[model samples]
Target: MSELMKIQENLRETARKLLANGEASLVIGYALGSEVSRVVPAFISREDEVDRLVWNPLCINNLAKYLLDYRHEPGKVAVVVKGCDSRAIIRLLQDNQITREKVIILGIPCPGLINPDLVAARLDPGAQITVAAVSKQDFSLQTGEGTFTFTRDEALLKKCRDCEQHTPVIADFMLGEEIPPNDPGDPFVAVKTLEELPVEERSAYWDKQFSRCLRCYACRNVCPACTCRECVFDQAEPCWVAKANNLPENTAFHLIRAFHVAGRCVDCGECERVCPVNIPLSLLNRKILKDMKDLFNVPTPGTSLEELPPLGAFTKSDPDEFM
Candidate 1:
C-alpha cells in the first residue's frame, strides 16, 4: 500500500474509534471534493461516516481555525492537523480561543501538498482518483483514465515549497510517521528584496496591489490570528475604516490589519491564498515578521506558546523607538 493510503486508513480507523467510544463528539477531516484534485473540510460525528475521511496532497486547508466553532460545545472536538495547521492550533490555545483540554489533536506529518489548480489542469475534473501518493519528489494519482505523475516543481503549492515543518509540534495522536523538517532558506528573502527598493517604488508597488482590493475581507475572515469578537473594520459606530472600496480605504484596511497581527501572524499564507485579486499578503505580513526579528530577535509567531508576542510583552532591553 502507498503511504498516503496507509495514513488515510489510520486516520479513518482512529476517527471511528474516537467517535464510537464517545471519546470525541466531532472529527474534523478532509473529504474528496467535487473535483478529484480538490478536498473539502469534513466534519464527522458518526463512526460510519469516518469512511469519508481522506489524506492526500489535496488536503491543503488548515483545519485548526474550525476548533473555534466548537469551543463551547459539550465534548472534545477532534481535528486533523498538518505542520502548518498545528501552528494555528497553538495560536488558538495561546489566545484562549479554545482550551487544550476541550480539543483532541490528530496530527499528520506532511512532506508537502499539491496545488489544486495545477492538478485540476492536468486531469479531467470529473475523473475519480482511485489512489494517490505524495512524496518528497513528486505526486502520483491513479485514475480511471490512467496513472499520472507530476514532479514537485510542476504541482507543489508555493507555500509548501519552503515548508520548515514536516511534522506537527503537538498532537494527542500522531497519525503517520514523522517526516524530517526541510531547510527553509531565508524566510525573509522576499522581505529583504522589497526593503532594498526605493521608497517611491515600494509605495507604488503596494498602491498597485491594494488598488485591486474588492473589500471582500476574505483574507481577514480566513485568518486565524484575527479572532476578535468584533473587528474594527466592521464597527459602524466608531467607523474606523469606511465601507468604500477605494484605494485609500483599502490601503487603510490592509495596513491596519498588518499592524494588528504584527507579532501574532503565524505565516500560514492563508490570506494570500484566499485573496481573489492575488495580493501578496504573505510578503506584507512577512515584512513585519522580519522587522520583529531584526528589532527584538523573535521567531515566527504561533510556532510556540511558551513565548509571548513581542508587542504583548516588554522588558528592560526592549527597544523603545518613540523615546
Candidate 2:
C-alpha cells in the first residue's frame, strides 16, 4: 500500500485502540459531512466510530482549536493534526493553555489540502468532485465534464502554500513519511506589496476593503488565540473599540485583532478562511510576524511553557524607532 493508505490504517488502528480501551473520551478526526462538503471534522467517542473517520482535501477546518475547548473536559482526547495544526499546538503549549500530557497527537504528513472554493470558481459550482488526486505540485479533480488540474500552489491555502514548518513540532504518535524541510520563500508578499504602495493609495486601498466589513467579528470569533473568557470588545463598560461598521471602527477592530496575535499568530490563515468578505487577514498577521521576527530574532512564541508571549513579556531595550 502507498504511504497515505498505510498512514490512514495506522490512524484508524490507533484511534480504535484509544476509544475501545477508554484511553480517550473522543478522537477528533476528519469525516464526511454531506453531499456538498468534502470532509468535515468528526468526534469519535466509540470504537465503532472509527469507520467514520477519513482524511481528504477539505479536511482543512483546523482541529487544534478543539484542544482549547476539550482541555476543560474530564478525560484524554485524541486529535489528528497536520504540520500546521501541530504548530498551533506548540503555541497552545507555549501559552500554558493545554498541558501536553492530557491529549494524544496523531500527526499526519500532509501533501497539501485543496480549496474547493477556488476549484468551484473555475468550474461549475454544482459540479461534484468524483475523484480528487494530489501530488507535491499538482491537484486534479474529476468533474462531470472532464478532469481538471491545477498547480498545488494555486489550489493550496494561502498560508499553507508558503508554510515553512511542514512537520509537527510536537507529536506522541506521529504517522506518515518524514516531512521535508520548509522552503525558503516569503509568503508575505501581499503584505509587502501593500506596504510598498504610497501611503495615500494604501489608505484608499484598505479604506475600500475595511469599509466592506460588516462588524460580524467572524474573524475574531474563530481565531484560536482570541480565546479569552471575556473579550474586551464584548465588554460594554470600557469598550476597547467602538462596535460600529464604520471604516475607522472596522479597521481598528481588524488592526487590534491582528496586533493581539502579533508575534504569536501561527499564520494558520483561518482568519482569512472564514471571512464572509474575502479580506486577506493573514496579510495583517504575516506583517506582524515579519515585524516581530525583525524586532526579536524569535520567529514564533517558543513551544515550551515557561516563555511568556510578547504582549505580557516586555524587554528593556525593545526598538521603538520608526524608520
| Highest lDDT scorer | 1
- Model 1 steric clash total: 0
Candidate 1: deviation at residue 286, Å?
0.5
lDDT of 2 by residue, 261-304 (tens): 87777777788888899887877788888787777766555343
lDDT of 1 by residue, 1-323 (tens): 88878889999999999999999999999999999888999999999899999998888888888888898899999999999888888888888899999899999999788888887888999997878897667899889999889998788888886687889978999998899887878888888899999999999999999999999999999888999999999999999999999999999999999999999888888899889999999999999988899898987777777877888887898997899
Clashes in each model (backbone N, CA, C under 3 Å)? 0, 0
Off by over 4 Å in 1: none
Local error of candidate 1 at 117, Å? 1.3
Residue 274's lDDT within candidate 1 is 84
Clashing pairs in 2: none
Candidate 2 segments whose C-alpha is farther than 4 A from its true place: 118-133, 140-150, 302-308, 311-323
Residue 226 lDDT in candidate 2: 73
What TM-score fits each model? 0.97, 0.88
Best by TM-score: 1
